[model samples]
Target: MTEHATAVAALTPAIADGPQTIKVIISGGFAAVYRDMLPEFERSTGISVETGSGASEGAGPKTIRHQLANGTKADVVILSREGLHKLNEDGRIRAGSEAGLATAPLAAAVRTGSRKPDIGNDVALRKALIDAGQVVAPSSTSGQYVRDKVFPRLNLPDTVRLTLEARGTEAAEALRAGKANLSIGPTSELVQESGIEVVGLLPPDLQLVQTFTAAIVSDAQAPEAAKRLIDFLSLDSDILLAAIKRAGMERPRG
Candidate 1:
């Protein structure tokens, strides 16, 4: 039997007779891989996945934590590890269900046809950011990383513009509109924008290898199914790696 077939067989003891769907609330980080792999998961396990999108971290109702607090129903959540930590702090996630899915390196982008920023080294990236004048980043973990670490380490003066976008799409939109000269976010998110072209990942010193995690909600409607879904995502295999690569992500590093 194939590896997928064996895993499905092992996971099937809990599956019921009829149609079953598990509602999932996920931030942008894991959505691409999840969306790409969901159909196969469903086909193998006879489980339907209902997905919802939100930022992993931010100050508004659009964040996963905010939605969960405001009574957004979900069995599972997929979001940045930082956001998952918050959910755990809030006592919203089931104990010990957290699983790391994949990690993506922070990337930089410029408007289509614009000059690609020099990101060959830490010094080059710092100079690029300074020369660009303004940078737009999503108001999620990646944005927070920029605010707390990347910007400060580079000593970008307050005069250099910085804006927190609500989502990667918004950050990319800002570049497309020429409102900003650069954007920094996960490669997965940046690749989705058609009006922008990625320059390259941030220099190694400034990179944020954001890990996307999956966990069952504390009040999940289908806890077993949630566990199964998380397992499907977390377990490494040829197919899973292929899906992650397709989404511009990779297996989480130790």
Candidate 2:
């Protein structure tokens, strides 16, 4: 069997008849953090989770919608707060089941072994952008924040040309390739990929917190298991929040 098949095979025994297995489609943003903790969750409850990564913002919700449109299976989803809310409004996710998981701030990251930029103050921040030949960032959320907020505030709209990556990790890849002097995105997304040093968060005055939320789908195959996953995300020990922080997120207030 292939590696993915092997993973699914390992999970089959834990899938119960009544609770069944929770078919989860999660954002690539959260996958790395939560992947390490799945075994413990499955071991404790006899619940199996199948996760998907890649895509960002509305991408996960759109995938869920296409699946639902075609009658594919999905019990839960974790993605940007805005996406979850949109899904709930569209009846793709259960309205009452939506839960906020964690919030990640936008940050600038430099490639490993590259010269670090000064993002400390408005003036220094402007100079750094002008000095860098190119920059890569997402078109959504973080990208909007920088283009709409950061650049204008720093008076450097003309300094750095922003390359809007379709996915958050793509910016990190740009940084690794040296195609761009800087990569900026959700801190969680930035920290996951190798070959980058998170320069530090954009100063609080310039930062935007993108909340990541999770929800149990109304048509979930395993409602109980789905709820279990939701509960795990809310708890402090689940590592979702920690991973977000480790990836560069700020601690959220309850």
Question: TM-score for every candidate vs. truth?
Answer: 0.93, 0.81
Q: Give the per-residue lDDT digits (tens) of candidate 2, residues 10-97.
A: 4434335554577887765565556755776666666777775434342343344445556767888877776566667778887688
Candidate closest to the true structure, highest TM-score: 1
* Alpha carbon lDDT of each predicted model: 0.87, 0.69
TM-score, model 1 to reference: 0.93
Candidate 2: global Cα-lDDT? 0.69
Encode model 1's per-residue lDDT on 90-120: one tens digit a residue: 9999998988999899999999899887898
Alpha-carbon RMSD, each predicted model: 1.9, 5.9
Report the C-alpha displacement of residue 177, candidate 2, in angstroms.
Answer: 1.0
Instruction: In model 2, state the lDDT of residue 26.
Output: 70
